[model samples]
Target: MPPAQTTAAPPSPAARALPAARRSLAPDLARGVMLLVIAAAHAHLFALMATGTDATLFGTWDRIATGTMTLFADLRGYPMFAALFGYGMAQIHRRRSEQGREWPWTRKLLRRRGLWMIAFGAVHVALLFFGDILAVYGLLALVFVGALRLSDRALLGSAAAALLAASAFVFTITFAAGGVPQLPEKPQGLLGELALRLSMWPFMIILMTAATLFPFLIGIWAARRRLLERPEQHLPLLRRTAPAGIAVAVLGAIPQALIKTGVWTDVSAAVGAGAATLHQITGFAGGLGYAALIGLVAVRIAGRPGPIATALAALGQRSLTFYLLQSVAWAVLFASYGLDLRVSTAAGVAIGAAVWLVTVVLAELMRRADMRGPAERALRRLTYGTTAAHGRAD
Candidate 1:
């Protein structure tokens, strides 16, 4: 006899949290690549801490490696991450609303997530890496979501205001300091270190948010336009933006690159500040340009989803987990308390790339196994309670 007709169970909220069938490839792809870029960007900080100056830290491959990083990776990754974070935040809100979650509920969920993020970031910085963006993002998520309710014109205007104000503030400070000033302090003990890191966090977040405001704003704007979500629909815009944004970013970043590579080591403080101010101001364009370029790549890979892209996208999907992993790796390899490994400019980059590559493999494996990264799973469970995660379905 035919078995009693049975029904399939619905997808769990946990499963639903995974990208739906209609999930945009562009964002994931962009995020995956962004991690690598971020990894590269972060390596310099470790190197900087080890040797004091980012310009002098390189052992042998000084000019070429640092120069390459300056030209391509430095000051480029954070903006992309910021913009993408804003975009993802918008997506989260939109998805919840579409799923019939009320504003109050959605807002509460975001705040909870933001709180957890701040907690995680604090812990991360205390234990592992100081150059953590998680906390900054957590803070941003809490503060920036309010702007989502604004009208399009208001939102854009606010973003512009934020960017301009941030630039002006930083520019004035840079001008006062004479150029990209360095902040280095020696902590007496682990406790001192912890306090110092926490103390430094707020200022860093505020300053960083301002510098990267354009990306966050554009991310929100792009999300509203569904640009990344519907890449096919925005090809023209992406195509035009990809090159233009990149050009602006590169030109703007050149001064920093020159300084970083010691090409003009003796520039006056004012000149140095001027170069830094240019770099910071132009970084917005760089961040947006990078996103546009990634979108264009996604468009080209429309029919053919290659293994590399697939791996990158998987890495992107579990980016938070891998991002944390990067910090762990840095702690293990670079921190004074850890191995305290020091190497040439090229080697630091290689190490960072290697860590990121390891994550790509791990993430891809998890993707294939239909499992989430441990951090991701924890965050998801925290973000949406176990019952909701298990019972609710999209």
Candidate 2:
């Protein structure tokens, strides 16, 4: 007798969460959230620096606000963004292969994006803040493009090893030298800073390149495992990952926090720097942990539709526009050449929240009108070299 015909199971809830032809909304939403946190951090920095009175109505709140910001910075966001970037590259590769197309063009596309980003970042740094990450990310992307062909496991392992080695190297040099090298003490004025940054670009590129690789590798791993594609399959893994990540992040941040708070004295600084070598270990552990937690959250939220999540996803879809807009807005608000509000801690938090709210509302409105942000549309056109009726603004 012929064996009974085998039947395939229906797609699971998680599997259905994302369209087969499109990338996951969860990653985009996660990116949007990271951008908001970044804005908040920057706003706080501006307020702290610009406030005339050393103390104000918001002054008392700085400790808590600053602490929270510092914690968030150390725990998530940056790493998540980096990992997502790598994941995105993988997605591009997979899609191209599925279409029976060569991926060399994609490399050129990425390079173009990187070059553009570096150009934008330079303007941002010169006109706004020297701490901009765009240039760093752009430079790193160029490096990561070469690693796209590595097997997922190989990519992950190599990235991990590189992070460890780089961190070790940084810690050893900094400790031996008595501390991390910082920009010279007096604000060298804007032109001076620009010149200095240009001179130091090579070193910055190297450091940022190493720092970005691990996250990119993690992204590639996630794509290979279909982690983002099917979040439910990874729920149990995420549950275990979140708390572990938080613990590791806390551990990694302790030495830095102690030094910042004066709890670690000059004598302790030396000892702490030595101990901080362990920070690299914790950073890797915690960064991956947070990424896992966020991925898990995204998985859970995938099935249940919520307005906020939808709005965030919209923002993520148009992230390039929002990102550039934020930079422009911040430059206007904080730069000496612009309005230069430089209000205070409390005001910064308020402004950040306002920016987030406004961005969300604007993003939702644009989505409703079937419009992508101007910058995003332009980038897509440049990358794809086809207008193709994409990004219809209403």
Candidate 3:
């Protein structure tokens, strides 16, 4: 347990964030690869005014792409990241505790970071993307920081409760609504579009917070176990979870995939609602499965990581930058005021893949230059204030 002192500790001049050398490979690799999944998930949304995977038409390749993505990528990417976010928080706590900072000081630091993240998310939404998750995570830190002190049993129990609550809420909402809401007509200008996105941001925050809280809590539980950081010690658990969780995720996603691919058309509202809920609930498993799979990979490449692995870790380190860049790509490609490309789903996926590849290459270059991502640099400065350099430790 962290020290329970109510007073702040004297600030150490040398106190800093974890250095890159001390960082584990698995989380970075998971994040690097997860970006591809996230890209795949969002690419189609910008295809032709599609909000996300609601494409009305599909060719043969589109069907294949849609099926594969639904099985592996849809609703699967963010949960892993959410878990990583929680794990990161735990890491922060541990680091601060070791620095002789008690709970009060660490809590203040966390809330400070959370406030900055909320600011970052607001700008991200107003200027670039409507699907910003930074705000949701920030809000989580603000609200659930105390969860860090919960006992193991309490942590797991809370995770279970959050999962059930999310599932029930998803089912209830889908059942009541009966169908996906229609996309509003394109706004007249950039200002108008910004207004539309801002208007919806609050609701997205609520829904995403509910959906993500489960994984976030589970992530904290996993971190307490050091599951990702020391995968070699937990080989049996990782081996079992990778396959089983992925199997569940794929199997649960089938109904939704079939529905999307026109193979299970004319479905009743109840069936659709159930499928949606099932997809969401099982997606959590898929996310963890992907993380476990990455952990196994980390175990294998522990001593000698290849160029691909190296590049991926570099990208993961700068995931925030690339993520925002992706939003920029989407805005340029799909916005009514921009290219407004109405490409097919397959084409959009291709474009998304290309975008990811470009980011990978750029990330590799940045890594070689020993440079941090711009967004990360800015956030570090904001979060660490005058000690930003010592705080990040480059």
Candidate 4:
């Protein structure tokens, strides 16, 4: 008699989510560092809101912080995230394809994830913060998931068009208005605040989409080449991008920074608008350059990352959790019903850095314990199923 035979079960869809050891260090590291830049930028904006003046002009340290942030951090942070988001999208698609999943099914999965993210953004705005980017990226995913199937030339062409359109829109608006738009007044009560946030959310989504779409497309292009994933294979390109992109970003930022810091207060509207247009365009380079530079760092520390590198990578792996945590901190610290601390730009920056450091430590602890960030876990469950979500990385 022949012995009975049984077939092994197939791997779950969620199993395709990159495991910790197998995940690329560069993308995660860039994300962790980008959070710091985001924190500084937001902190500066909040400080400016409170002061009702350009916070950069407050003091020597404030001037230094603001200029540094504007040059390297301000518009830089979100674009990096946008590119990374595109990269992640491609990653998911690639994994699904390798698993023998068809394009239509994968497309549905991506859309489902995007819808959940939009829900998450709504909750975030209602309870914690107003400047929620999750929804913006969510909408991007919902709209552009098809781009994953696009040819490289098509992707690049679309990105270029989007970039030009965004640049033209910014230039036209600024030129017409003679300056950037002013921040809205902070509403009084919790209900009023919620209303204001919700009201502003749609407008923000539109603006952020325009600003982020180009990089998001560019990210898809990079992912197709496995740029970040296989940094060693593309050393020459990364090397060239790092310095050239940063240099362009810095030069483009100088005029805008000077104006904001009051050094060029008497400049005409045309000059101010032109400076803004240049900043907007160059910011894309800055963001990509930062990512490229981080990729080089990852190559140098490839096999054995030190303690700090390990911690930062951990935070990056669980970025959604830490990012939301930062929002909660901001709300508690500055909400009208909360402490409402209106510190200087320098102080705000210091506080933001401190908050980011605390997250780093917390993320390191979570890494040791082999715990997924609560938000990441939830998102995965929503995206895949309970079985697949059990042990997944973002």
Stretches off by above 4 angstroms in model 3 are: 1-14, 48-56, 179-188, 390-394
lDDT of each: 0.77, 0.64, 0.85, 0.86
* Candidate numbers sorted by TM-score from highest down: 4, 3, 1, 2
Model 2 Cα lDDT, one tens digit per residue, 159-239: 879777767766766677665333333233456546654665666566656666777777787776767667678787778
Report the candidate with higher lDDT, 1 versus 4: 4
Clashes of each: 1, 0, 0, 0
lDDT for predicted candidate 2 compared with the true structure: 0.64
lDDT: worst 10-residue window of model 3 = 5-14
Which model is ahead, 2 or 4, in terms of TM-score?
4
Give the clashing pairs for model 4: none
Candidate ranking under lDDT, highest first, comes to 4, 3, 1, 2
Residue lDDT tens for model 4, 224-334: 889999999999999999999889899999998897777778767688778888888899999999999999999999999999999999999999999999988888877
Model 4 lowest lDDT segment of ten:
1-10
lDDT of 3 by residue, 51-113 (tens): 343544667988888788888888988899999999888877877776777788779878988
RMSD (Cα, Å) for all candidates, in order, is 5.6, 7.0, 2.5, 3.9
Off by over 4 Å in 1: 1-21, 53-60, 183-196, 388-394
TM-score of each: 0.90, 0.80, 0.94, 0.95
